[model samples]
Target: MATFLRENASELGVRYVIWQGRIWSRGAGDQGGWGRPYDGGGVYDPSDATGGHYDHVHVSVRR
Candidate 1:
């Protein structure tokens, strides 16, 4: 799913995506896509199953 979104990001207006503790942003470009890891911080509880987004994918779209 991440690969598909990254492939068509321009057409889909995808700003970024968070999944499996990693993040990919259009602004960062392909070379850095998903290279950055996302720590839950205060938003997601690391102790929880879905806190690190291990069970799901979070897609952020541009308006």
Candidate 2:
């Protein structure tokens, strides 16, 4: 994800902040149909990608 962000940072105006086991947006906020404090956890998959229980990325974009 870091590589992807670096490649499109300028074009997409991407910005981020990391805290409390989650990443937050410095710019984009609750605009992708997702509400603030998006918690990326649901069904637990043992063989899921990221080699973790959840197959999603946690992102919080608001205070």
Q: Considering every candidate listed, which one attains the maximal lDDT?
A: 1
lDDT by residue (6-62, candidate 1, tens digit) is 779899999887777777887674445463767776789744669877788788898
Residue 43's lDDT within candidate 2 is 45
What candidate 1 gets wrong by more than 4 Å, as runs, is 29-33
Go through the candidates in order and give the clash count of each.
0, 0
RMSD of each: 2.6, 9.8
TM-score of each: 0.76, 0.25
Q: Which candidate is the best by TM-score?
A: 1
Candidate 2 lDDT by residue in tens digits, 1-63? 533553465565656532223344545554443223324345433244442313454322223
Residue pairs in candidate 1 whose N, alpha carbon or C atoms collide under 3 angstroms:
none
